[model samples]
Each structure stands twice: as structure tokens, then as C-alpha cells.
Target: MESRQRALVLHRLPYRETSLLLDLFTEQQGRIRLVALGARRRRSTLQGCLQVFTPLQIQWRGTGGTLQTLRQAEALSLSLPLTGRALYSALYINELLCRLLVPDVSYEALFGQYLQTLCQLAASDGQYEPILRCFEFALLQALGYGVDFQRCAATGTLVQDQVHYRYQAEYGFVTAAVASQDSFSGQQLRALAAGQLSDAATLRAAKIFSRLAFKPYLGARPLKSRELFY
Candidate 1:
């Protein structure tokens, strides 16, 4: 018997000559692999609906373990197109989710944030740097690696404007008389604390900080999609 669900296609790869193997982020199932049989044939409805970044309602069967077969899929929203840098950024987000999020885990809030981020990136006129940073922070929080930006991780003092600090992956941010060479500016840290996502400089700094913070969790394997941005 097949169960119906909503999912976003994070990644898809060709299987044999006509089918596809899809890595999907679902509302209830988290991440799962679905086989789309004969999807590559010309004029196939599944071919058009199963593209990455597209939102769809999918039906599949096979015990929710591995290699389940998709039974039916229908589009849930208008297609959002992402090009150039936005395209690469979308790919990076997908890669991050694919690598970090485990199968069968329920991350509904993070899933919603992921969808929102993709829509924002596709809009073009909006500033996406902040959206991306916010999504990254939310992802970390969902995965139980949230940082404490409201106060010093060391002395428990409220983070002040004049204090220099260094962020450690396991310990959040700590005040240091001699700050790390790569530490972000006080203004940047303040902006992050306030959840202000409009400043380009702050967004840039936050991205670097997020990369450092995610390193230990990511292990030695590099995110392949990140290379497209360089």
C-alpha cells in the first residue's frame, strides 16, 4: 500500500536509461530516496514535476526504509526559477540538508524555513544574503547546535558593543582580550544577535562564522555544491 506525502526534491540523479533516483525532504518523513520509474521518457509528466526545488505532493510505497518507488506526484506550486549565484546558493542549501539531516527525522520548522529561503532566493529583487544566513542558523538550531549570541558563552555577561570575541564550535562566543584574527566585528555580532538580515557586511561575516561553526559537525568531507560559488 502507498502512503501520500508532501516533499521537496533536494537532489535527483539518473537511474539506468529512463528512471531517476530522488533524494527528497518530506514534511513527515524527513529525507528519503524515491525511485521514479521511466521518468526520463519524452513527454512524461513526472519528468517535469520532479525537478529539484519544485514543491510537490508525492505518493510512494515500500516500508519507508530504502529505495521506495514513487506511485504518483503532482505539482503543488508555481515553479520558481533560480539563476546564477542564487542557483548555486540553492544547490548549497540542498547539499547541506542532504548531508546533515537524517532520514525519518521530523524537522518541520527547518523544512518550512528551507522552503522560504528557496522562494526568497528565487524572487531576485529581495536581498538573499540575510535569508541564507538566517536559514543556516535555523538549521543549526534544529540540529541541536544552536549558538548563544545573546550573551557571552564564557562569562555570562550580556554581549556589549565594545567587546571583542571569538566563537568556538562547541562553546559559542567568548570574550577574549586578544581576539582571533578571523573574529567578526562587534557590529557584525550585534547585528547577528538582533536577527537583522539587511546588512551585506554582517551577512558576509555570518556566512564565514556559520562555515566555521558547521565544520566539526560536517566532519572532513567537503560540501561539493559549494565549489560552484567560487
Candidate 2:
């Protein structure tokens, strides 16, 4: 059966002499790869619609395998005008989705969240941190690696506002005696739990927490987008 959905091009590369291979995140089909025949040719209309961060209505059909042939693609709206940090951050989000999300599965909510993240990034200047952090946390939760910030993993005790804690992957947060570079304050945890990153400290903590949380799944290979940040 043919599947049609709204998608965003996550990554694309030249295929053969004239085609393009695309990794796409679709609202109905999670992440999938497609071959856009003749997309690289000068007159191919797919060239314009098949771009990173462009919202597209795409159509495809295939049997049981990772690769499919893209039948059609059309831009749903003007591509979000991202530049500098926002552009890099958008790339980071695309890379994360391509890396961590399972192919051929449905991540309906996460797909919407991803689009919203891009919109938020495009609308702001340098305030991409909180937006990225929120999307990262959401992505983690959607991938079944969500860590609870409201309680201690060690004792299941409620996280206190005055204490500190450290994230232990797969295991949730554990209480820390004092704050350190590796530890997060209870207030930060609470703010994160509430999805309220109101201060610099909480934003900083969220970044560290997300990096630590993603380390295991992302393996040792550093994300290429991370390099763009520095």
C-alpha cells in the first residue's frame, strides 16, 4: 500500500549519478529512507521540495526493506528561515531523529513536536537552548529512555528543592551530597520536571542532563551537528 504523509527531510545525499537518497521523518511513518530518482538533475522539481527543514507532503510505496522509492514530494509551506545557531540547532534535531528513532514505526506526537521545535527555533535568535532541551527531553521520552526528575532512583524519595542529584543512565536521578559539575540542583530538577526552564542554571542543567542521558544510546560517535556549535 502506498503511504502519504507530511515529512521533513532529515538528511540527503547524492545517489548514483542523478538520483538523491533521502532520510525523511514523517508524521505517519517515523524515519524512513527513500530514493528520489532524478532529484539531482537540474530540471527535477523534487530538488526544491527535498531539503532539510522544509515541510513537505510526500508519497512513497515499497515492500519489506529500509529503502523506498519516492513517488512525489511537494512543499507544504515556505521553508523555515533558520540561520546561525538556529540553523545548527535545527541540524542537531534532524541528526538526532535520524540517529535515534526507529524506522517504519509511528511517532505521531514526536513528529508534531519536532515540527514545533523547528518553528520555535526559526522564530527565535539565540534562545535555541531551551527549545532544543525541551525537544531533546521529549525525544528521550518518546524513545522509552525518559528519566524521572521528580524523585530519586535510589530511594524513590521525592526530590527536595534544596538537595542535589546526578543522572545515572537507565537508573534515573540519584541524590548527590553537594553540587558539582556533574550534579544538578533539586530546583533544576523540579523545573525540568515541570517543563519550566526559567533561568540560566536550569537551562545549563538541562543541557548536561540531556547529554548524559543521550550518551549511551548515541554511542561514542559524536554528533556532527555538535561540532557546528563550536
Candidate 3:
């Protein structure tokens, strides 16, 4: 049977001689690996359309195996013109998705959110923190590891506006005996919960929280896209 869906090339690599292997995020199939036969050939039309961040309508066919063969791919639109920090941010999002998403499972809402994030990145003037934080939080929720900002997961106590807490990845936020430099205030957590990056402090807190939330799933390897920042 053949399957067709809307997709974005999350990553691609050279395959053998004139072929390419693609990691695609599809609306209907989530993350899938496809082998694009002869895509790297000089005369192949697919060489131009098989690009990262480009919207595509793809068709593939396979059985129960993990890999599929690409039957067709057509560009739905022009590739997004993301550059500078926005470009790096987009790469980070792609690499993060490739690392965390389970294969073959449908993430329809997340696919929409990913497209929206790309559009936001294309339109922004380099203030990417809030955009990234929101996407990261949404991805966590989609993965069933979302953090509860309104209450301590350990104690079930309401998060007070004045109290400070420290994040424990396995257990969520807990009351801290001392307000260390790394601690997050209840106000900041609440602001994040409300989708408000109202101040520099709150923005900083969101970045820290996202890092902590993703640490366990991401394991020990550093994300290649992150190095582009420095």
C-alpha cells in the first residue's frame, strides 16, 4: 500500500552514491525514515525539492520494516527564508524533534505547532526566547512529561508568589531551603505557566526550565545545533 502525507525534511544525508536518506516529520505518520533513490543525481528533480524546512507532499510505500522507499515528493511551497539566530533556532527545533519523537506515531497537533513555530521564526526580529520556550513546553506536554507550574509535584502545595523553588527533573518543583541563584520564584513559574515572558528574568527562567525538562530524555550527547549559538 502507498501512503501520502504532508511533511517537512527534518534532516537528510547522502545514501550510497546517488541516493539520499531523509528523516521526515509528517502530519500523518510523525517521524519517518525514507530512502530517496537517485535523489542526488544531477538531473533528478528531487535534488532541488528535498531540502530542510521546505513544505512537501510526500508519497512512500513499505511494509512493517522501519524504513520506507520514497515514491514521490512535491514541494507545497517555497522554503522558509530563516537566517541568523532564527536559522539556528530552527535547526535546534529540528534536531530536538529528531532526538525526542517516537517513530511512526502520529503527532498531528505537534506537526501544526512545528509549522507555526517556523512561520514565527521567519517573521521575528531575533527575539526567539519566548517562541522557543512556548514550543518546548508544548512538546513536553505532547510527550506526556509536562511540568505543573501551579503546584509542587512533590508536596501538592500551591505555588506561592513569594516562595522560591528548585526543579527536580524526576519529581518536578520542590521548595528550596535557600533562594540560590539558580532557583525559580513562584511568580516566574506562574508567568511561564500563563505563557507570559514579561521580563528578562522570566525569559531566563524559561530557558533554564526548558533545559532541565529536556535533560533526561536528551541523554548525554550535546545537540549540534546548540553549538551554532557560540
State every prediction's TM-score relative to the real structure: 0.91, 0.97, 0.98
For model 2, give the 10-residue run with minimal summed lDDT: 59-68
Residues 68-133 of candidate 2: C-alpha lDDT, one tens digit per residue: 999999999989999999999999999999899998889999999999999999999578899999
Worst 10 residues of 3 by lDDT: 59-68
Candidate 3 runs further than 4 Å off: none
On TM-score, the leading prediction is 3
Better of 2 and 3 by TM-score: 3
The C-alpha lDDT values of all candidates are: 0.85, 0.91, 0.93
RMSD of 3: 0.9
TM-score of 2: 0.97
Q: Which pairs of residues clash in candidate 2, taking residues 3 or more apart in a chain or in different chains?
A: none
Which lDDT tens digits does candidate 1 get at residues 117-188?
998999867466777788899999999998878678878877877777788888888776775556765666
Candidate order by decreasing TM-score: 3, 2, 1
Sort by lDDT, top down from the best: 3, 2, 1
